[model samples]
Target: MSVDLSGAHWFKSTRSAAGNDCVEIAHLDGGRVGVRDSKNPHGGALVFTPLEWDAFLSVARGGEFDRP
Candidate 1:
């Protein structure tokens, strides 16, 4: 299903530095989520379903992306 992201209210992590090189997230309708780069707000976003977002968060919290 295609989501209308024209009005997405994107926000980034508060911990992000002032350099503007961070990822932004927006809560879309129908329990969907959108992610994009702060450097280019109009560059489009990667959409994710609610379940996929949950699974991603779970793995992220588990240090899956941490350096070995």
Candidate 2:
């Protein structure tokens, strides 16, 4: 699925530090989500479908990615 992100209003998490180093996210049309690196706006991005995004959020909230 090709999702256009040219006009995406990307934003970082509020927990992010006040700097250029962070991840940015944009809620796109069709319940899609966009993600990219703040330090490289022009760099490539990852687009997630609604289901994928939800599953990711579930895992995240479950702390599946917590540091050991």
Candidate 2: regions farther than 4 A off: none
Give one digit per residue, the lDDT tens place, for model 2 in 10-44.
99999999998999999999999999999999999
In model 2, the Cα lDDT at residue 42 comes to: 97
Q: How high is the CA lDDT of each candidate model?
A: 0.92, 0.95
Residue-pair clashes, model 2: 0
At residue 58, give the lDDT of candidate 2.
100
Give the per-residue lDDT digits (tens) of candidate 1, residues 1-68: 67899988989889988888999999999889999998898887899999999999999999999999
Lowest summed lDDT window (length 10), candidate 2? 1-10
TM-score of each: 0.93, 0.94
Score candidate 1 by TM-score against the native: 0.93
Q: What total of clashing residue pairs does each candidate reach?
A: 0, 0
Off by over 4 Å in 1: none
Candidate 1: deviation at residue 19, Å? 1.7
